[model samples]
Target: MPAVVVTNHGGDVPDFEGKITIYVIICVFIAAFGGLMFGYDIGISGGVTSMDDFLKKFFMNVYEKKKHVHENNYCKYNDALLQLFTSSLYIAALLASFVASRLCTKMGRKPTMQIASIFFMVGVGLQAGGINIVMIVCGRIMLGIGVGFANQAVPLFLSELAPAKMRGALNICFQLFITIGILAAGIINYFTSKVHPHGWRISLGLAIVPAVILLIGSFAICETPTSLIERKNLDEGKATLKKIRGTEDVIPEFESIVAASEMARQVKNPFSKLMKPSSRPPLIIAILLQVFQQFTGINAIMFYAPVLFQTVGFGSNASLLSTVITGLVNVFSTLVSIYTVDWAGRRILLLEACVQMFLTQTVVGLILLIDLKTTGSLNHVEAVIVVVLVCIFVMGFAWSWGPLGWLIPSETFPLETRTAGFAFAVSSNMLFTFIIAQAFLSMLCHMRAGIFFFFAAWILVMGLFTLFFVPETKGVPIDSMVEKVWKQHWFWKRYMVDADDEEIKEQVHPHVK
Candidate 1:
């Protein structure tokens, strides 16, 4: 038998049986495939748009504009329809999350993920084979709906299944897989760009691989004991809890989950309860983190790195290669987060990254503002410098805001409002992601190099927000965050007092220390 490990966070939260079991590892890696699908789309979309063959076939006007030797460096890829191809999925994701939240609540996280995979596979087919703009855009919309479901379910699934002691490292696997997917897309797009007239097809078609993996993987992993227990499958839930914990003595943990689920069943409407005082801390923090994550302009850079390289004077192949370098940086830096997030804690990494990103963003802005002219591109040396600086910025983001943005919210919400509150977080992320993906090229056209400073300013604000508003959530059990984290937070605690606490107090020993 595997050794039973019990860790206590000052006795404020429950100590449950936890071990690094192979069964749990396999389940998490499988669920994390959803992130791979998402990341591939993000990384591939920009590179595909930059492909000559891809543009010539679907967006001829933009392709012609790119061929002009005298085109303004900042405005070459500023077509609205082209931006729509990249951003339409996010808008779809935003709307689909509400429906996904319902499905996650009524069905289970596993089913929602399976649904997401099916939708993404269809999207991959439509996008790869699309001859018309309508087919491509419609495919993107389907992909968006799929992303909506996956994003809504995956993080919450990981958090619920993960041991509180190992939660940060495990939950972050979703982001780690996302970074790997981005890296894979970059490598594929680099080789595929060499193929004439159909390379983009291959890039878009490959999205189906991860989608298929996620679909098959979803069936193999057990439904989270939290979800199963909440859905009233008590016997299986306990058996699962025992298996995942690597121990037969899971009575305490199982009973705790059951108690929480019973309280959740009392609340007929979680969204309504989510607006009440007790829910404010998680709701506010979750939404703001998502909005701020996008405003950091991480997605802006990820979505258009290749285009930005081209604007800065790298040739087509060189631009694609540079994007690949940054993709590599993004993937490796995320590994740092996985190893250190549990040990080093969340705020320190986040604060350190804000400073690093601020300096890099500002320096890149200055370099572009000085060397990159409106009518002409940066010189070769300066262009190389710009890519290096952007790599530094990407490193800071991939390790810090990128993973924690999802990790924090997924762990913060109480069971009664967990899925519903997480839906709000997902919608907020998708909404801002859409805004950034859609407007970034036009914003570049208008703001020129000043766009970097704009994002840098937002990074500064994110640092301040983290300093004061965000509470440390290192070892608190997901089930006890209300009592152990939010209610204890200096600024957030005021929102904790209300009828909800008293009601929970009266009913059971759950929801508080």
Candidate 2:
């Protein structure tokens, strides 16, 4: 038998046992499949749109019919239409995320995740079989809705279920799966694109496999104890907590959860409370971090990497291959975040990543701009340089903003406003994702290298934002985050108070002080 472990939660409670750790890990993996599906849908479209057969089936006629009038105009118009097709999912996802907030609260986390899986299955079916633009559009919308629900609910589910010490790494696991999904889609696209006429269908349909896995896995995972308690099922909540913690001495944790839920219930209007003076700081932090994450040009690079590579002198096959490299770098680099997030802290990683990203984006823009101004085409060396710069930029993102952006909001809000706060934060992310996805190609068409410069400027702004405002949430207990961190009047002063420091804790809570 394994030795009983203990936690310091004001009393001696058994620490998570081996069996419970296994159960929690299994649940997290199942929930994270939602992220895998999210990445597959996002990455699949990029490759699918690049496929010759896909283009011929959907876009060739438009180009052919209008080619006589002006070839460039027709091509531009078709590109715009394609952009709209790609962005449709994001728009639907934004709307679905808000709905998921209510659904997750009402139905509980497990059921809400199952709902997303169902949407993903239907959406993947339509897209795979889609013969017309209308069918594809409808499919994208369904997938978008699924993405929204999964994005909002998965992180929240993982956070609630995970222990504070491992919470950052587990939440980052959500992003890790996303990168894996992207890499998988890229590999699938690379192979399928070689098959010609029906390859795009295979790429689009492959997403269904993960969606099916998620649907089945959803049945096995337990409901979050916090959600159960909030619904007033105290007995069931305690039972679930025992299962999750793998120990019968779950009284302390259960009582803590009950207290938090009761406090949340006291606030009749969570939304209005969110807008109050006391709640504004954390809410602002959540919203702005999400905004900066999107505005940093990560999605633009993700969605159109193949096309961007082709523009800089690579052939279609090579462009697709290069996209695989981007996906690989993304996956490997996120590992850095998973390992360091707990050790190095959030604020430092984010600040450093922003600086590196700023430099990389600037270098990419300068190289592209100089190429346009001088040779009008990149030499082999310059092309390599551009690719190298892009890889570095992606590395900076994978370890920092990419994971922290999701992790922070999940940690910031009090339980009272957590669901609503997450809804708003995720909706913000999706909304910007839509704007960036819709605008990327058009901006590239007109601005060329200037688009990279635009991204560089935003990255600089993000670095400053981090330096001044973003709090370091290394080992802070979730229960005390709102009272200790968010309610602090000064940004610099926020870090002065540590949740674990008894003296500092006393200062924050006057009665204790």
Candidate 3:
């Protein structure tokens, strides 16, 4: 049997034996639905964009009866405005993530998720029937708020509640569900866009059903034990731990919770704390990982695949169909990551993904920049090359960076600062996402293939950074894993050690500092 080590608050670790619990998996699945929301929100807008012609036609009729408001009035309400229709959801998420770091801490995880679901349902409902852009933005914001809450809260909650052995796998489930959501949206859009005459509206409205289902699911769960301890409800906290831990002694677990909370309370300014010299390494890693994840060009592809295909000489329907294929590649690759993450480890997968992505994107950039030079036509071979590169890039991301980015931060963070740590990471992610989404359309217009080159360079940097700096985290227990990382000497060592060195056993477990 695998050895189990347990520790109480501010105490030396103790040993125990048990199997991983079902409750942890249950929580991961429920919370990961929030990722589904993220994916749905991200992809559903593309389908909505598909209906721009229909919308213009429908609104044109109304505008004609109103005596022609302006010659190009609806032109002002074209793709850019429709892009905002989807982009606003993420904008809302960016704001909500900041608020959530504070709110989730005070309100506790279960209640907060319930509240988010309510907002999600409300937002999706309003958005589907929204007559004006104003109403649409409002609905988008509602869903955004829920998404923001889930993004920060769910991963943080899952990390804290899960067993050390399974934390990485559990946390990656969030990303896995995101891929699943993207796939679902793509498939649904593909079928519905043909079957339903008003397909895009139906796609936008489908988000409401999932939100309602998640809301109902929340009632069957209990508050995280950590939150109970944070509130000084020791008896309830202990009982909750026992319920989850099952036959395992509760005192040590309860004590560990109290100790971590006490230690976290001392840090006061979580953001400021991250900037201190001692804390800077992890913060940089967290921030850079988020930056690279965005610049790896995943979202850019997802957001504008159809436009890209059209620009590369494909019809509108063909472009959408191609996007569905890309989404499938993404979903399957993510499932591969879910199966391999704990087995292959985070750092290895990250490095491998970055390298492969760099090569594929380089080919793609060259093909776009040189092969089609000064010509408006793309040859069949060149088109196939672009599709293959895009597929490979998506595969690399799905199996590595996509899931591991979310997993590593959850593992690296100390409990006291986990929420705040994730907040910074998530905020950094949003900042980059915002930058890319806002400017990518313009960049495609002006720079075109140059954008792929820019992202390829980012991937190259990400690959080198991961190779040198990112430590192997697979199978490492969270508390001990954190302690070990902090104990590393950044100053010149007498001799360099091998990259694959096994972590010192003593450094694998940590208590509340």
Q: What does the lDDT read for residue 471 in candidate 2? A: 75
- Looking at candidate 1, the ten consecutive residues that score lowest on lDDT are 1-10
Candidate 2 lDDT over 119-198, as tens digits, reads: 98999899999999999999999999999999889999988887766778888989999999999998998999899689
Sort by lDDT, top down from the best: 1, 2, 3
Q: Cα-based RMSD of the predictions, in order?
A: 2.6, 5.0, 6.7
Worst 10 residues of 3 by lDDT: 492-501
With a 3 Å backbone cut-off (N, CA, C), the pairs that clash in candidate 2 are: 5-15
lDDT of 2 at 383: 84
What local lDDT score does residue 376 receive in model 3, on the 0 to 100 scale? 57
Task: Give TM per candidate.
Answer: 0.97, 0.90, 0.86
lDDT of 3 by residue, 1-513 (tens): 232343223233433222456765676677778788888777766655654443553345422422332323112223455456657777777778888888777788877777788888889888877777788789988988888777887777777676655667778788888887887787777666675456766888898766776678777767778878776777888777776655457665567678877766766678776664555556677888989999999988887776576556565577678888888898889888878887677888998898899998888888888765433547877886788789999999999888877778767766666677777787777777777776676566567678899999999989998888777766544555444554453531111232123223214643323
Better of 2 and 3 by lDDT: 2
* TM-score: the better of candidates 1 and 3: 1
Better of 1 and 2 by lDDT: 1
The segments of candidate 3 whose C-alpha lies over 4 angstroms from its true place after superposition are 1-18, 52-80, 195-197, 373-377, 489-513
Local distance difference test scores for all models: 0.92, 0.82, 0.71
